[model samples]
Target: MKRYLATSAALALASGSAMASGLDRTGQPIGIIFEEGTYAEFSVATSSVDLSGNDRATTTVGSPGNPFQSATGDVGDRFNMFGAGYKRDINEQLSFAVIFDQPWGVDVNYPVGSSLLLGGTTAVADSNAITALLRYRFNENFSVHGGIRYQEIDGEINLAGGAYASIPGGTYNIRVDKDGAFGWVAGVAYEIPEIALRAALTYSSEITHNFTTFESYTAGGAATTTETKTPQSVNLDFQTGIAADTLLFANVRWAEHSVTDLIPENFGGRDLIDLDDSFTYTLGVGRKFNENWSGSLAVIYADVDGDNLVSPLAPTHGYEAIRLGVQYTQDKMKISAGIRYTRLGDAIAAPGGAVGVANFRDNDAVSFGLKVGYSF
Candidate 1:
């Protein structure tokens, strides 16, 4: 009974990976960290952001804004993702696992016709991580787990349109393809099979990358090199059985993004993109119906902390989201799916400080996910 119930709760969490809040593309969830026996799972998800406002550019660097060349409408991007994990128990007290994820990322592309100030301005960050972990069970209620990770990141940026008519080549374009960096994760977990309760605290070290990059301002510009790191993070996950066949779960995550600097010297030494330390919280409840079905609903929130001078690259501030998920199990396999809706908080965006746009409020997004798991 305890084993099946735990599977149900985990399945619900996997399904709930439909969307993440803030500029967080990967929720960095540890739901799969508790899987039992020899198990494997695969998941895919997608999200659409409707980020659009105004193009605040001036006639020159320190001049007043131009009202005639303004543009408006949606300029957000649609993202697709996938991940996989595998875990094997070596014995009653030992286990090993491997997990793959696209941990930290970004995608920003203003429409070519949206506004003269931002038209053709774009940026993207692509990353992938692999983690190999080992776990040891010390009795019926306590355990320890630790792991090492390898990740690679690559990105590109472009600045064009009427806003950049003053640079060395009237525009800026840079690209970075970085080598893998090593990181570590360590955690302790306490579980009570009698009450079907589990609590875990995990910390992940920062992974830095030294990118071999190229840059250009015009047709004859040369390339440059730089380095950057994704912030270190901590996650706490807890779940307990409160009623017959029902479970309650909660998670809190914090990332040290406030102190990490990502400005490359080739990019004018200005911080192109960053976040105020990020915090996300989640609460959910799941119910098992019979032996082959279970479902859950959850609420998620993340606050936009720090200075409010928003970067157009990362426009949305904070967000509140609602998610629903369901799973179906047959024999040794389970399939799960979920949908989520998020209400993004408001903020102001302006580059160059000459002219800017406020009221990036009331924005929203919808996402969907699917997961398949099998046990041996």
Candidate 2:
């Protein structure tokens, strides 16, 4: 009787499989694909952040600092994606499925030297991707999977020396252009029918980004260029259903931004300014009120500390966020929407802290998404 009771409890804990769909900061989903099905999905999201007014002048420079310099601005961005997939049944005890999706990235603009340009442009780090996955089911309760990823990344860095539409001239422009690189991922999962519970563990391998940049000289002459590659990252997620109407999920991710050592290859590396590794964590609960609707709330934290800071013009430090999401499903179709409020951390003053430099602070965003899936 005691053994049977213990087994029953364990099954209960595994009934409602908890799933971690996306990261709170980058706002990327985690789940892969539906079982033995084909579907199409689309999503659109947006965000806004405001900076704090801390004197950006360095004490070492002995320069009179300008107070009340605000880095607050509008950073609205969006994403568009479309994918189709299928799941195949091998036998009663074995099955296979394939899925495709677009992963992570960011595109943002800030005031150049406290002055907003008509473009209000400063720097841009852009990224995009396409992923294909295959999964095998061992039985009614267990399975494993793996996949490949191809990605494209590029960016531009504009320093406070030249003039563009709204800001002063003399700023520096470091332009980065890249093609693509390949990566991989693998994971396992288990399901318990007795209590409607399930659990899964997934590992996403890092994909390297190789590219080139042209450095614009403030003095004169044409642009000088160089080549380099950005580092990779690892993501892990675990989810479970704790109640008939409630599910819990958590995720952890590690990113090596330090791998990015130079902008324009000809300029060489910046020893005094290099980025370090970063770790992010997320936890949330999903509640299903009825058969057709559900809602979720999650909190996230990131520790972006570095003994060596990169991009003297940008920000350094970890961030935190609170995210809320809701989903509606009706006969082969599901729609999801989410909003997040973020608090960017603080950074130490560097050589470029003078002029209108300010500590980074912005964590406001609003997002909406729609996905339609069909089972075979």
Candidate 3:
């Protein structure tokens, strides 16, 4: 039962989330520390998104009489993520682990010349992080863990459209240099191996980055510095044996994104995007058919505020998804694979918080993942 639970949780983690709330990608998991004995794993996931929308007729400037109607084309791009981790037990009560992952990202590209209002617009953000942790078991059922994380991030953005007409040539661009920062993670857990049950609660602190930024338009360009913060988050993970060879798991995650803001000095100090707090919930069950094969199914949901207005750079609002996975284990080696399909909620892209610029609906994404692990 314990092996079945771990396999299913790994599958869910590998599949990841498509267009997760508030730029979240990995959910900053720390489960490897609980693995039995010494273990190591590597995983990869890729997602293809179909997101498109149309320019709002009433919001198109200078076309008051003749409403401008044009399709925005597919703005969301395909992306890939990679992760690795190693865990080792020093004694009966002490353990450690090191993990690597791409925690947050954004990719958006509007087709050029398709939509008069938002043609040639693009935005790309990338991040990489590493965490080192130590866990100390206090008794048969209680344990505490803490860690330090180091992360790096960078991005570039290009804005074009009548909505940005204030800028020369109705185009604006910004590039941010990679920056690194440090943060911390702390958590507590309770386990009852007899019943294959465990509960964990974790907190991740926010990390701040000061990036060198360059801004440009048709006329010229200027260089300046920008400050940004990655949001703090909390996660609750629970699992237990529900039946013979069966395990049930659930997770809840919350992120405080209101404090995370991007205000480039050259852009008149106006925040590039305004994001709200976010919550995500997941539930799943895993069943072992025999000694070598086990399978799992899960559903995921992210909550959205009532407001549909959103930044054009990150257009989609909340999401609903279902994932399916299978695992095979032989001796010391294990392999897992999973797939997820996500239906994105409708949203209105309103650059600078002005609503009715564009309507994005009927968008969705599909993702696949594979992982390999070995125990010693």
lDDT of each: 0.74, 0.48, 0.87
By lDDT, rank the candidates, best first.
3, 1, 2
Worst 10 residues of 1 by lDDT: 15-24
Candidate order, TM-score descending: 3, 1, 2
Candidate 2 steric clashes: 22
TM-score of each: 0.92, 0.73, 0.97
Better of 1 and 2 by TM-score: 1
Candidate topping lDDT: 3
Best by TM-score: 3
lDDT-wise, the better of 2 and 3 is 3
> lDDT tens digits, residues 192-261, model 2?
6454455656666655555555666555434444444444566565556677666666777777666645
Model 1 alpha-carbon drift over 4 Å, by segment: 15-23, 56-71, 162-166, 352-359
lDDT of 1 by residue, 1-376 (tens): 4765556555555544433433457765555657877898998888887776665545653466545535445656778777888989889999988988887667778777766666787878777888899888999799999989998887887877666666676678878776788999999999988777888899888877777777777656665567676778898888889988888888888887754455666666766665667788889888888788888889889876765556666777777888888888899999888888888767666554334443365678888888899988
